[model samples]
Target chain A: MGSKEITYQQIYEENYPKVMRLCMGYTVGNESLAKDLAQETFIKVWQNLEGFRNESGLSTWIYRICVNTCLAEIRRERKKDKNLQIDNLQVSDSVDNATEKEDMLVQLYKCINKLSSTNKAIILLELEGLPQLEISEIMGIKHEAIRTRIHRIKQQLTKCVHNE
Target chain B: MNNFEDLQNKWQNQTTISATEDGFQSLLKSVKFIEQKQRTGNIVLTITIVILVAFLLYVSGYKSATFMLGIGLMICSLVVRIAVELYSLKKLRTINFSKESNTFRSDLTSYYSFRKYTHYVVTPLAVGIYTVGFIILLPLFKATLSNGFYTYIQCSSVVFLMVFSVFLYKQAKSELLKLKQLQLED
Candidate 1:
């Protein structure tokens, strides 16, 4: 594949996992919804590829689209009273057979979904190892606010995961 | 109780879902479909507006008061509807997709509400003019067709306008409701 032709394919291949992971967090492990949202996000990226000015890094641009796409899907789900976040989730607290690590992983996602959408994007980016400055840039917020928000969101996630 | 550190560790370790080869192809096809669909809609609307403007120019010379009035109302309604759609499209085009989540949320809400206003007010006006605009052509239709055919044409035109208006109204309402729910949750 020529560079011109495979450019979009290359980006999709590289970012698909991270995009789906962000959607997974946003949708609270509603796997099908995550996939659907991921699909939509990539479609948008493909459509708008020509318009990208490189003002923001490609990853940041794609992440922003991912967040917006997930938020849009979540909103549509809410209108249908779809219980997309906490309720329909197959979140299991029982570690009876699964490892303790496995059980906590599910709980962590549950807690992540408990957060507001912006926080979900923030913490997901943080967990994915994006710098706070980059997260702030992608989120259109002050760097300081992102730092404070990350602290607060972590506290909230901690509480939710522990059922405190 | 998992602390923030523990949660972060688990989150990072969680499995990532990769798109299957077939899944990627399907997604690419969907992107093509969506682009085609959007382009089709825009082209049809543009063509309709162009045809209406051209026809209005052709009809303007006749100087019948009712025909002129009907033409005027239709041109007004078409312009408003197109302007609203253009404005919505412009807002969407300029959206900094990499901006703040809150900004995206608010902008989406704003677009839907503006569209709702246009659909709510302009659709009815468009329907009214559609009926009147067709009726204005009754004289021309009568010159070529029987009275029964003219009556048939008028009734069908009105019915089509009503159906079209209702479709627009329902679509706008559904869009607005989705945005409201999104903002409500935020």
Candidate 2:
């Protein structure tokens, strides 16, 4: 196989899992949707790989594409059926011994959903262990801006999670 | 453990979605779909450009020919753009986000595909075509291409596009952050 094919395979193997996980965060662990969006994201990355000017890290570019893809999906949904609403959204329930971890996940999503889209992106990327500079690039913002937003978002999430 | 850090740490401790074959398969399929669509679109666009270039060369001596060619390219580009947009709209229309579980995901996938077209495919192509049109018309319209006017226009446009793109990106990012905040609310 050519280097291009090899690189594409490598990208698929290395980034696909992380992209799906990221999609899961955005989709609130709706596994099917997460998988679909993750797949779409990789397809985009592959299609545009030649245009990856290297100005930003490949991972950052990938994240940017993923976040934009997710947001665009949300926007499109909003337009098509104005009355559409997320149903039976699994909010964090009362903590129990057996389901504490699951409950935390649910609550985390609930709190995340409360965030503005950009803040959601910031917090999610932060949670995913992306660096500040990389987050800024993916977010198309200054590093200081990302830092400030992260600080504010964390404080906001803290308040929300505690109150829950 | 009661502090914000503790809360974040706990949140972080929650397990991620496990990787699975189904997920990979979906991703691969979507990628193939997008690739096919992009290829088709590129082919159409290239053909349109070739036709326009031929027209321009053929009618080099006729002012009407230049005008006709310009108008033709503009119309073709606009039509192609509209077709692409309509295709996206149609794809999006099929998604029922209110349905259980995967609906939002499907909607999201469509949305991303639309954005991928707009950002990676459409925007850059539009810009390039506009640049070409500008260049093509400069000579035909009797505008001096050597007096640094072209340079100034190009420079100014690039600056404007960069600033506008960045501004738009920031606003979108901020909006995404706001959504995240809203989702977090109790």
Candidate 3:
């Protein structure tokens, strides 16, 4: 019941980059979609900030919103009718004559897209250096499951990137 | 491949743009509009139901079977509107922002599908009932009013509602198609 009321502007300035990066993981490095998802995440955060009970970390709450926004975008697209799926729906991974490292990063994004949504959040947050426990709390899963899944998703991503 | 320092460095160093104040303002405006729409719809429908109840109470005192049946149908239509609104609100409430993306997708997909049902099926059925019930009630009203007045009121209301319903139906259909067209490519 404590009123540690942080303003939405402060939250947006501080967490926008991290949220955008996380959204990119969901979007296969598509920066436009990442930006939109980030915007939507912040919008939801702004709307729900008053209801935040201050029980857990702010990042956990914000990350939860980010994940949900990405999920909603996907869900909405999937539910939409089949005929008009062509409009801005595909995120361009437009790379022109990339080096080996950039190629690997492209492959990394492709593999990330292939992972389950839970595993995607797990590995992306892991990559972002969020502590595993916080990732678990953000995801509402057990700490051990997160630890185990991160190991599995890494193997999965490596094989996927290598096309093995 | 095992070296994630490069990836971590790339992510941490990512230069990003945030939503501007104008963007937030527009977003907040849209959010407020939607909330206001919900509130207004609920209030209007509840007021209608209450009025129907009071009217029904008064009408029941007159002891006319046709009038009672006519008012009963109106009450039914009000209930139908409330039911559809309640169903939609429930779906909106269930939208989970914290579930894993796949589960979240499924939940929201179902929610949209239900919404489509309400738009295409439920609302139309309710309107159909109201239109039929309104037509039926004209005879009852005729028992009291003069021929000229009844004809004038009847023509105006029926024509107005028929035109309005057609407009609404067309709008809803176009909206459904628009939603259908927004499918995302993988």
Candidate 4:
């Protein structure tokens, strides 16, 4: 294989699950939409691979792309129906089919969806085990702000899941 | 009550869809499809401009000042519209997705505003100029053609104008609505 293809293969293998998880959070556990958004993120990654500079870690760049792709979907969805809600009720409706852990996971996504789009991205990356510094870098916010936001979002999300 | 650490443990252990070997191969194909789609759009617009210019040249449209003015306006409108689209495409490519979220959003906001300006102002002006140019050529068409053909041409042009206006209005409205949504985000 050529150098570019080999590089892309490595990047895809290392990052796909992480990207998918982040997308799942953004979509409120809607696996189908998460998969589509993850694939779309990779498609963009493939398109812009040549333009990638090594200014940041490759995974961090991938996270940025995945976040933006999810946010873009929100704009597209809004254009179709201005008042369309995310239908988090679907997750609850299917709760009987899920394990206890899966039910909590679903509840976690529901709470994540309640935050603003920016906050959803912030908390997802935080939950994914990224460093606050890296999350700040990906989000273009100060490290202190990211730290504080994550702390507050965690409390808010915990209460939300408890209520559920 | 589950603590954040317990929640984090559940998140870490969550089952993720495995990326298969075939997925990369299919992704490669999709990359080609996307490039082809973008190229096809530009190709169609470029070919239209070429055909219009060639027809104008073959007719020696510059022989009469009125004909030149009318055709010139029409061709100019087409050329400018294509240039704007190409420029927008280039600007979209320039957006660095790897940048921080706020910077990325800022870049997008600018792009959306540029598009809004194009839709609200540039598009209407271009369509208006095109319509006027078509109108300017009507008297010539009436004088040169047989009465039946002239009537047909008049009817067809009016119908075409109505359809074109409605199409443009819907397209611009949809685009502007999406851009508005993007700008509204935090």
Best by DockQ: 4
Of 2 and 3, the candidate ranking higher by TM-score? 3
Docking class of 2: incorrect
Candidate 4 structure quality by residue, lDDT tens digits, B1-186: 688887777787777776889988887788779989988988987898789778977868357888878878887887788789789889988887767889888888888789888888888899899889888988888889999999998899889879988998887787687677667666
Chain B alone, model 4: TM-score?
0.82
RMSD of 1: 4.1
lDDT-sorted candidate list, best first: 4, 1, 3, 2
Off by over 4 Å in 2: A78-98, B2-4, B7-13, B18-26, B37-186
Cα shift from native, residue A125, model 2 (Å): 1.0
lDDT of 4 by residue, A1-164 (tens): 78988898899988998998898777666677777888899988988898898889998999999998887676655332333233432222234544677668767766787788898899889889999999999999999988998999999988998887
The global C-alpha lDDT for each of the candidates, from Candidate 1 onward, is 0.76, 0.63, 0.68, 0.81
By DockQ thresholds, what CAPRI class is model 3? Answer: incorrect
**In what order do the candidates fall by DockQ, top score first?**
4, 1, 3, 2
DockQ, computed on Cα atoms, for candidate 3: 0.22
Q: With candidate 3 superimposed using the best TM-score fit, by how many Å does residue A118's alpha carbon deviate from the native? A: 2.3
Tell me how far candidate 4 lies from the true structure as C-alpha RMSD in angstroms. Answer: 3.5
Candidate 2 residue lDDT tens string, B82-106: 6666676667645532221223344
Model 4: pairs clashing at backbone N, Cα or C within 3 Å: none
Please identify which of the two predictions, 3 or 4, would achieve the higher DockQ against the true structure.
Answer: 4
What lDDT is obtained when candidate 4 is compared to the true structure?
Answer: 0.81
Query: For model 1, how does the per-residue alpha-carbon lDDT over B1-186 read when each residue is reduced to its tens digit?
Result: 467776666666666776577877787779778879988988998898789879878987886786677667767766776777777888877765556677887887787777777667766776677567666767877788898998898788778777876888788777888766766664
lDDT of 1 by residue, A6-118 (tens): 78788888899899888888777777778888988988787778888898889989998998888777766643323544333332345562366666666777677667777
Model 3: residues with Cα > 4 Å off, grouped in runs: A1-6, A29-33, A79-102, B2-15, B19-71, B74-78, B87-91, B94-186
lDDT of candidate 3 over B60-81, digit per residue (tens): 7977777767767767886887
Tell me, by TM-score, which candidate is best. 4
Q: How many backbone clashes does candidate 1 have?
A: 1
